[model samples]
Target: MDAAQHISIYSSGNRQPDYSPLQSTLDRLKKRTEENKVTINHTNTVVMHFCTSSQAVAHPQLSVGAHSLQLVQSTRLLGVTVDDRLSWKQHVINIVRTASYKLYMLRRLKSLGTPAKELRDVYTAFTLPTLMYASPAWSSSLTLTQQQQVERTQKRACRIILGPAYDGYDNALTILSLPRLSERHREALGKFGRGLLCHPCHQHFLPPDAPPPRCATRHINKLVPIRAPKTDRYKNSAIPSIVHMINSV
Candidate 1:
């Protein structure tokens, strides 16, 4: 099985993040691969440096043996497009493009007099999954505009299904017994947040449970909130957003 590995180094107060440690780690990984008689797929190997700073900085020159790895502004890992800034804009664009193309196929099926029920099934089976894929990871990071871009695909699908009696996006969803994409995202995020609380491995990712209130306050069971994030991108990330959701509930 092939897997992508991420190595992160955080910057301290007012200090520039360093790449030397990352370079050393990659050197060791190359050595280990050679020792184990495993070949590195240099063509597929690339480096991405994530940062929210506006100041221009030097890109790390990373290598595996004699070959220098390519530095990409964005890359896809396990179907999620992650960019250097972690804004999730590119990821949303890619998924929207893909779901739109699938809708074209759905339009063809509709023209052939496919049953409304069957068309809905085709959508639920084929297209909805495309939009919801890995949604829990990036959904929290989406801007209002990006969220609408995603929801428009579903709205278009509803129009394709309902034809003349479409009425509106909301009524189409209600008539078809479908929830809004934003609602689905909230449910997905909530479910994922609850799962993290129970999951043995991922539970550690959450903040420690709040200590009991001295006077038995109503908010005794919430998880401690994390330190304030320096960037909005980090503030709206899956973990932080989910943590806030869990705490509120």
Candidate 2:
């Protein structure tokens, strides 16, 4: 990490509204995540399975919830040190790249194009139990080619975010950054991966932002949906404040 570029440019880039230094860092799709089960020998007796809500592996819980947690936690430690920042930033970039590939792959799958509603419903149903990773999200029925792609992305996410050395598992960037008060906010996950706010929380971890469902503005938006909206009087314990932070971002 170049001190000049990393400290000033990197930190400042984070403050900018549309700045994305990560865009360049995230090149081709990363490698696949490892299987939940690690075979000690050729024998099938010692089998291990990555448990989730459903038998289907592509549903959407662990993929979304877990990933989000890792991202923010790493960001929280940014600019502090070299060894601390490297793996976190690398993992963050890797997860983002893998997640984008997943959305693209899902969208590209002709079978998934039956109807947007059905697709969404199927996703929700297959994903509900696994909502917090109680099931498998993919199927063995996919063509060899597609299976390879899913494996690639999943492996990438798993390796970097859920891998053996993922910075003590304290990611969750955007989610924890939400207000703690609102109870209606749902986890704002990408199509296939998680964000910081993995589960429901009544207040923003940062403190100043209103809860999720409530607007930081004057009124509470029931129609807006999602648990935990920010409150009108919400204030940030951090230096500038969430309002200021949001604007800066």
Best by lDDT: 1
Candidate 1's displacement at residue 228, Å, is 3.0
Badly placed stretches (over 4 Å) of model 1 are 1-15, 210-221
Candidate 1 TM-score, true structure as reference: 0.88
Window of ten residues with lowest summed lDDT in model 2: 180-189
Residue clash pairs of candidate 1: none
- Whole-model Cα lDDT per candidate? 0.83, 0.27
Runs in model 2 lying further than 4 Å from the true structure: 1-83, 86-88, 104-109, 120-249
lDDT of 1 by residue, 1-249 (tens): 756554443333223657777778877888998898777777778888776678876777788889998999998888899998878889989999999999987799989988778888999899999899989899988999999999999999999987887999989988888999988998999899877776777777777763332345554346778798987877888989987897787
